[model samples]
Target: MSVLLSACGDDGGKGNATNTPTTNNNNTTDDETSSGGSEGNTSTGGPGGTTTNPTSTTTPGDPTETTEGESTTDGSFITPPDGGGGAKECDQWTQDCPEGQKCMPYSGDGDNAWESLKCTPVMENAGQVGDPCTVEGSGVSGIDNCDKGNMCWDVTEGVGTCVALCVGSPDAPDCAQPMTSCLISNDGVLTLCLPSCDPLLQDCPGNNLCIPNPQNPDAFLCVLDASGEEGQEFDACEYINACDKGFTCANPEIAAECDPMAIGCCIAFCDMTEAGVCTGQNAECLAWYEMGQAPPGFENVGVCGIPQ
Candidate 1:
């Protein structure tokens, strides 16, 4: 695991740059990806993703039939809300589209990562949340079998799981399922709610790392472990997910070992519950957030750092 949630405490972190969400910035839309893909294609830095979440879609086959080697879907089909058509722009959150059509986030500019929102037809027998689903075009194409409020995740060559969209508004987004954290990436184009996990256990499936959401350090999300160099403790890092597993980047002032010139550097996380056992030069297992601030199950979270 790269970070923790439930609240994960904090990174004492500052964004610089790194690929997130499957190393691609593909996490955003079930419709338009909401364009929450990976951070691989864009800007400076963020912890939101590159788990390649758009690793997100597939073209639909017969809704009621599964041929050999095909995955079966679960639950009743969900009908997407509608909006008018003809390339009319729409909002992913509001989902105000025409009958049978839904608002989806997609790469309208062709740069990928669901940079824009558009209207598309909902699949017949659209897959419900947590069901096996499919998508059309590319991951960010915003066309898929997932019902509104959900997207196909971890798509591999056009197959993936139907994951839920964040339930709340963008500024204070959250997940409906317990222990899930909302991940916002691609400059707010993507809004995904992913399961949270333990950093010590490194429990995330596949190659993903459990890291703090770059937008909200204490609330961690399962993001792609895009550590090209696999930075070690005290090694300079520019992004929250750059360090090796169990390590995260922090402000330089957090440790004397960190080079003063670097924007941030990798540091190990510690359990505040085991206070005396974790020590460092001018550093300690300090609470990652103000006491009583961490979400339940994360009260014990801490980081090895100098008291500021």
Candidate 2:
């Protein structure tokens, strides 16, 4: 019998424990297009091979796929609002921060991570989704060139690509891209529509990592790397996207190199069809899911772990 390891639990902002698997999060009515091969920011990751909105061009402990709908990070997880970033000012869905100002998610305490919501003046000629953007303060500062309904994402240095935010009620947030799923963060202050991906291909645009969705681990999505603080191999990991580009969080027991006391730790993913792909001693590429149980197009997905 296979031993049940602790779920890669405990976060830079980790994925949820739910294991709902699907080719698409919702039964997408449209046949979502297969992800593009360029792995470049120019291609739209939309459903039925359609580009809802085309954007401008654009990881890892060392990053390859780019951003997703509200999706961002390694391993996967959510960050609760600490209730410290800023006082509630306006509604993000309504874009009601006031004329000339827009509501955005940002770090009120000056911490590197986004912690709350605030109203900031919209830039003149703010960039739109699929456009190049710049951040005013920090990447999480929430001040950017993107207009309301969109935000700067996959930011490197102070420049990044603009991606759409989630619309509809928070309880049923939606994205224009049929293949993307909404991910909520900063205690629901920030909402994104991240692109879903095949874990085996890791085909996110421009350095985004592909891992199991925090919203649905059985499904994969493209996300940023550690919010700019990538985790190294064997580093204690909580968030699915916090790990370096080539690394993934594993149950500590499977990662022999991890500190014994850690909850989960960073490890590399390997191809099941290849041997000697794993970097750790006694580690091997073990099937990520039971034989024949993997989602279509991901039959070869594997993780570096000790044989049970």
The number of the candidate with the highest TM-score is 1
Would you estimate the TM-scores of all the predictions? Answer: 0.66, 0.63
Model 2 clash count equals 45
Q: By how many angstroms RMSD does model 1 differ from the true structure?
A: 10.8
Model 1 residue runs over 4 Å out of place are 1-88, 214-218, 275-281
As a whole number from 0 to 100, the lDDT of residue 198 in candidate 2 is 69
Number of backbone-clashing residue pairs for each candidate, in the order shown: 45, 45
Model 2 C-alpha lDDT per residue in residues 1-308, reported as the tens digit of each score: 00000121121121111111111110011111111111110111110110101100110110011112122211112332222234566777778777888877665553343445678877889888779888775555668888877877655445667878888875566778678866554445656777888665778876666655433334566764442343577776544454566656455566567766653466666678998888887877776655545567766777776776
What's model 2's TM-score? 0.63
Q: What is the C-alpha RMSD of each candidate to the true structure, in Å?
A: 10.8, 12.7
- Using alpha carbons, what is the TM-score of model 1? 0.66
Cα deviation of 52, candidate 1, in Å: 19
